[model samples]
Target chain A: MKETITLKIKDLFEDIGNQATFVGSFFRNIFRNGFEWNELIRQCYLIGLKSLNIVLITGFVLGFVLTLQSLPTLQQFGAEGYVPNMVSISIFREIGPVITSLICAGKIASGIGAELGSMKVTEQIDAMDVSGANPIQYLVVTRILACTFMVPLLVLFADAVSLLGGYVGTSTAGGMTAALYFSKSFSSLVFSDFFPAFIKSIFFGFTIGFVGCYKGFKANKGTESVGIAANSAVVAASVWIIILDAVAVQLTSIFVYNQ
Target chain B: MENVIEIENLKKSFNGSEVLKGISLTVKKGENLVVLGKSGQGKSVTIQCVVGMIEPDEGSIKVLNKEINELDEQELKDIRGRIGFLFQHAALYDSMTVRENLAFPLKRVLKVKDEAEIEQRSVEALEAVGLADAIDKMPSDLSGGQRKRMGLARTLIVKPEIILYDEPTTGLDTITSKEISRLILSIREKYKASSIIITHDMSCARITADRIVIMNDGKCIAEGTYEQLENSSDTFINSFFKI
Candidate 1:
């Protein structure tokens, strides 16, 4: 048991090192000549347009539920008018970034993992390498950058959808106008709330890209391992998203809220 | 004959098991050298090292008179740019149409900007392998022999002086295998290119080999013309010829 535990720890450290090297290579190759513009556009389209429906539905439902759950409890103190403010602050500040990231963690990360994993298993990567093409430039750099840019855009879109859902939920629960609800929502949010959330979402995007690419790039030589890589990418990306959210919140509290 | 590829004491080990134990061989210019070996005999590893795909633990690989291990990254890329490797599975990029796949390395590595030239070259490559009709078809849409032929077309696009065939006919039927073997011979004749064809397919060897090297226990055990090996006094070498 002791030896097994030691081996597991060793493997963990090795995997982390491999991922750090992979990220370093990604950055190095990003500036390399012959960027795959067509591939990048295709990826952005896939990541953004394909993920739109899920992000929209989830964000809307979560916002509605949050409003419903917070309404009656706050009605005890007759703070019903502040419901929009509270819900908006929560949505823009923390909930929007975290929930959208987790959703992407489930969808985009797994897609990248499975796609690249199958490529690796099928010797497509090897073919690229031997063909003297820059596989890293064509594959990893385009993917990581696509996620880093697209996920944040998805979050911003999701936040808007969720705000709309919040207005609908609040008006149905008691009574509120769209103009007044939206006004209160913005009134409660300052630059501090918005900027930090945006920063966190960007980090969440980075995490998803990093974990997904790492799992897929280093996939073992089997079809079964491709499935494992995809599953592990989602699991790993979700865990990292949560961890990054916590760190972002703590840092935001220290730097923004305190000041 | 001028040597195109020279491997000296090439060795590689995986998880402490030596796969290529001091393999030394050479392929001459415009000569088709086939390395015949059973599975796990390090035949693939040997060719893979020539292209600098797998690094040898201890030894040197010189291709076109340049030492692979000594070349820097860009130099390595420049060297590899001139060599075409067809994977055992053909390994066509599935996301690409056959034309796009052929044009990929041309545009990316060779930096071909003229669309007309790229299209012309891609179509010509397909024509060489008799796969021109399959240009717009995806790799998954093709049959096994067609895929292998398409793979040959993709590799031939770059006009490589040296071609590496890694089990080019491993999974195909005998008829298809013979066609691919004939293609390999025609490719060499038309291009005047040296090639290292790695395979255990005896018919492929009989069809394409100018010289044959039989590998066992990670080293070249015997080498001769096909007929020479076919009538060898050595029982072990003769066993491989026994249907």
Candidate 2:
């Protein structure tokens, strides 16, 4: 039992050390000369463009459901006029970014993990490495940067779509006009509310990309490891997103909202 | 003849289990030096160390007069540019077309920005491997033999001085294996490349080997011409040559 516990602790430390080294390499390569702009653009198109429909759909459902769920409680208190305000603040400040990032963790993170894991297993990454090409620069940096750049745009897009959904939900319940609903929604959001959430989304994006790439790149040699990488990427990214969201919420409440 | 690769007392261990136990070998310029070994004997590990993919725990690996372990990243990359490594699985970039696959090393390693030059080299390399018609096809679309040929085309595109093939024929039919062996010989004659081919295929050794080194238990057990090794009275060495 003692030996098993010791081995587990050692493995944990090793994983942490590996992650630290991977992050170091990422930073070193990101600023290196000959940045792969073309590949970055391709990844952006893949990660952002490919993920649009799903993000939109999820965002819309979240806003619609939140508004519907909160309607009766607000109605009981004779505050039906605040439905739009409630939905918008909830979506933009927390729900929009967190839910969108979770969605991205599922879609983008898993995709990168599986792709890179497959590449590693098939020796394609090693081929790139031995061919005098910087696999870290060409593969890891571009994917991470694309994720970092695209995830925020995706969150913003999801936020907008969710507001539209909120408006639709309000209209279906015969609560407000389209123009009135949108105006109320936008009115409730301030700089502090939006900025903190946006910044958190960026962190969430980085976590997703970093975790996914790290898991995939370090995958053990086997066909099964590809699936393991993909699965673990999603799990790790999701956990990191939640943890980051909690920390961001605390920091935002302390600094932004307190002021 | 010049020694392009010299590995002396090379040692590597994974999880305290020693894989390569002080392996020593050399490959001369424009020669096909085949390392014959059964599975799990660290044959692949040796060549991987030569290319500096896996670092050695002890001793030295010198490719083209440069010590592999001593070089920095850029210097290692420079060494790697001069040394082509063809992996066992062919390692064709699955996301790329055959044309793009051939052009990868040319663009990345050679830094050939000229589109026409890239195009010409890609076609020429593919033509050399008889894969000219599969240019636009994805690696997934190619047969196993075609994939190996495509891999060789990619390796040759950079025009490296030394080529290290890790099981150039692992999972092909008998005919395809012979064809690949012949292709290895043709490549040496055409490109004047020094190669270290790691394989257990006796027929491939017979066809492509200028000198053969049989490895077992992480050490080279015997080194000689195929005929010399074939005539050895030792049961262990004769077992390889026997029917």
Q: Give the CAPRI class of candidate 2.
A: high
lDDT of 2: 0.92
Candidate 2 — which pairs collide?
Answer: none
Q: What TM-scores do the predictions have?
A: 0.98, 0.99
Q: Is the docking of candidate 1 incorrect, acceptable, medium or high quality?
A: high
lDDT of 2 by residue, A40-130 (tens): 9999999999999999999998888888888888999999999999998988899999999999999999999999999999999999999
lDDT of 2 at B64: 93
Candidate 1: C-alpha lDDT:
0.91
Q: Model 1 segments beyond 4 Å from truth?
A: none
- Per-residue CA lDDT of model 1 for B121-168, tens digit only, reads 999999999988999999999999999999999999999999999998
Worst 10 residues of 1 chain B by lDDT: B47-56
